[model samples]
Target: CIHDTRIIMTFLLTATFILGAVIAGVYFFIKRIYSYWCRKGVEYIEPDFFYGNIKEMVHGKISTGGLFKKFYDDLKSRGLKYGGCYTFFSPVLILVDLDLIKNILLKDFDNFINRGMYYNEKMDPLSAHLFSLEDERWKNLRAKLTPTFTSGKLKMMFPTLVACSFGLEDVLSEYSVTQDAVDIKEVCSRYATDAIGSVAFGIDCKSLKNPDSEFRQWGRQMFKEGIKGIIKA
Candidate 1:
């Protein structure tokens, strides 16, 4: 019995030491990666150990865009023109200056081609869209699609868009009389859905009138899945 106890204790001690070493190594690795912006002499938001600056986003307390908007507001209030942040050890640059953003997006777009999103073209063929694609693929697809969105094409679609806005107007008018607090984000999302449904699918979704419309449900499901994936990543 004593011999068996001695062997069990030895095994436990070895496992504990290995686990502690692994934990320490991971802590140090994250610390080094998180210091990148600091080493580059750039201003950045202080990040938490594992989730970086997106703890709230990972916890589902805020959407990704909302979190970035908060970051933008915080940095702007601090009188910063630009700042860096971390998304799980990966450094992200936030541009607050209009001229710099314009230059990066328009004048010098080729230099900033990669969006750093994950997409497996072979496994998920549908995921290989323009936004997820990189370099030559993105450029080529964008070039092909650009002409379809020209002024003439948009003007032709304007009447359909205006027709869709009536549903939004009716809903707002009804809400105006009640004077109750409104979720404008949801209302706008429905409006956008209705607009897109009308213009693209040639189906009057009427999502603003019927919040439980099939298209609206689909949109909600897709958004929830996307946010869940972001949190998992």
Candidate 2:
């Protein structure tokens, strides 16, 4: 009985020691990651341990765009032209100056090409769009697509856009008579879907009149699935 108890105690101690070491190693690793911007001599917002600077976003308290705008405002208020922040220990640099943004996006684009987005071309072809492509792939795709979005093409599409707006107006007018609170974001999304469907597919989606239209349903489903995929990633 005494030998068995000794063996059990030794096993328990060894397991505890290994667990404690792993915990300590992970904590230090995270701390090191959080210091990335600091080591580069950049001013940065202090980050929380696990969630980093996106605690509100992680908790669904704020939209991603709203949170980034808030961060921009905070940095600008402090007279910062640029600043660093963390998204789950990944360092992100935010540029406040328009000139710097222009330079990075246009003049110095080659130096800042990678967007750090995830995409699997084989598994999900839609995921490999221009926005997520990097390096040579992005450069090549942008060159090919640039002609499609020229001024003349947009001018030709203007009438289609105007027609879609009329549908939006009709929907809003009905809601106005009923004095119902409107979800403007959803309304705009439907309008956008109708416009895109008309322009791209040469079909009237009628998303404003029929929320369950095939195109609108697919759009919503795609967005829902995309968000879930991003969160899981």
Candidate 3:
């Protein structure tokens, strides 16, 4: 019994040592990458020790887009070409100079095509839609989908837009008659839902008439700006 107890204790000690060493290794590895920005003359706010730059984003403070937006404003104030921030310990270089932004978004688009956001298909299916796909796949899909959204398509859909606007105007007339304060965003979103449902899905969602419509409900629910919206800032 004494010998078995000694053997188990040894195994536990070894496991603890291994875990500690792995943790230490990761800490140093991340520190090394962070030091490069300091050397490159790019000013980065001292990343909250462990979380690097995106500490706020990770802790439900800002969205990925909002995080970059903050950096964009800060660097612009300093007249710097760009600056660096972290997204969950990964370095993100945000460029603000107009020419550089143009190059990244267009001139040499392939070099900076990826937005570096990750989404698991199983977690968000519709997100698994075109917006989530990256690399050449995203490029090809965007090209193919462009034709479906051209001015020609909008011209064809103009009649439907006219119909929906008429529906919306009539609905607003009813509200004006009642003298009630309806949320404009709610009304506009419902009109959009009805217009899109007809043109895209070929469904009649007479949401303009019925305020208690599922189409309107889902439209609002989709952009509710929840806690995730803050994190995604």
lDDT of 1 by residue, 70-109 (tens): 9999889998989999988789889898988999988998
Q: Across residues 1-233, which tens digit of lDDT does each residue of candidate 2 receive?
A: 99999999999999999999999999899989999988999898899987789888777777778888988998899998999998876788889989899999889977776766667788877678877889888889989988878999999999999999999999999999999999998999999999988987799998999988888888887666333554643
User: What's the lDDT for all of these models?
Assistant: 0.86, 0.86, 0.77
Model 1 scores what on Cα lDDT? 0.86
**Candidate 3 runs further than 4 Å off:** 1-19, 33-45, 49-68, 170-184, 210-212, 224-233
**Alpha-carbon error at 211 in model 2, in Å?**
1.8
Q: TM-score for every candidate vs. truth?
A: 0.78, 0.81, 0.69
Best by TM-score: 2
lDDT measured at residue 138 in model 1 versus the true structure, 0 to 100: 86
Give stretches of model 2 more than 4 Å off. 1-24, 225-230
TM-score of candidate 1 on Cα atoms, chains taken together: 0.78
Estimate the lDDT of model 3: 0.77
**Model 1: number of backbone collisions:** 0
Q: What is the lDDT of residue 181 in candidate 2?
A: 99
Report the Cα lDDT for residue 6, model 3: 96
Residue 49 lDDT in candidate 1 = 82
